[model samples]
Target: KPFVRRLRGDLLAHGVPRVWLDEAEIDIGDSLIAKIDEGMKLSRYIAVVLSKKSIDAPWVKKELDVAMNREITSGEVVVLPLLYEPCDLPEFLKGKMYADFSKPDEYEAMLAKLLRRLRIT
Candidate 1:
């Protein structure tokens, strides 16, 4: 969660429009699934933080599934994964490349790689 917040801040600082599904952004009556779908539609790329926690999350799986669908249909790189911890990736994600974040010391380098992947300079 901390990494997600930090990444969101970093992207915002870099003038990248990012949509985060954290609790703070949720309204009292907001529909979680609807919000996620809307956000996915608005985003050019979806960054899935593949940590141990996220890997087990159903919501994350759903989001990734949606993103993968977009990628297949549009024939573009829509899902960019950040592997924050060692975990068995989903079958679909196994063949896709991901930015490694397992080594804490290499955070900046990984961030740079992510930005380059996003073509954000």
Candidate 2:
């Protein structure tokens, strides 16, 4: 709920675009390579909503793998993850830094922080 709401608000506030793998135009068929390629090609930045559920999801893991690779290969596709619920963030995201959305003010602050982190502010 929070993820979709925040994403909508972000889309409204900034005309920055976003895409979901499930709703993507391409046919992935659970292919790792295909998902990675599509994600990198279609999105300028990737926001992974990390939680125990998403963190353990195979799709999320694959996307992160692709995002990490893209980060290395092109230094593009910035992966900005928001905490939907309290859970342990993976090592990769843990090191890069993330905005906490555990509180209302923190969430809003994180939203602003994300803009600044991405240099949109």
Candidate 3:
């Protein structure tokens, strides 16, 4: 939660345009599915925070699937995986590198790596 908030803030501070959906941004009467679909369509990249909790989350799985498909169809890396903890990564992500953030001390290194991966100046 806090890590994600921090990441979002850091990304924004770097002048990277980002779209993140939280309960506060989603209206109570709005459709979550529609919002997610629109966000994915407009986003240049999808940063998936992988952890034990998110790995089993259905919505996360769905988001990963969509991102992976976009990567295949668009012939570009759309999904950027940020590993928060050790877990069995899905087959699609196996053998691929991730931005490691398992250690608090690694935040700067990981953020740099992530920005490089994003091609941010």
Q: Judged by TM-score, which candidate is best?
A: 3
Model 3 TM-score, 2 decimals: 0.93
Residue 7 accuracy (lDDT) in model 1: 77
Considering TM-score, which of the candidate structures 2 and 3 is the better prediction for this target?
Answer: 3
Candidates in order: C-alpha RMSD to true structure: 1.4, 3.5, 1.3
Candidate 2 structure quality by residue, lDDT tens digits, 1-121: 5566656567557644554544434464677567567656677777777778999998789888878887888865478887777898888888777767766667667877777766675
Task: Point out the worst 10-residue segment of candidate 3 by lDDT.
Answer: 17-26
Q: Clashes in each model (backbone N, CA, C under 3 Å)? A: 0, 0, 0
Output candidate 1 Cα RMSD.
Answer: 1.4
Q: Which portions of model 2 miss their true places by more than 4 Å?
A: 17-39
TM-score of 1: 0.91
TM-score for each candidate, following the candidate numbering: 0.91, 0.73, 0.93
- Winner of 1 and 2 under lDDT: 1
- What is the descending lDDT order? 3, 1, 2
Please provide, for model 1 over 23-95, each residue's C-alpha lDDT reduced to its tens digit, 9 standing for 90 to 100: 6566878888787777778789899999778988988888898899999999999999899899989889999
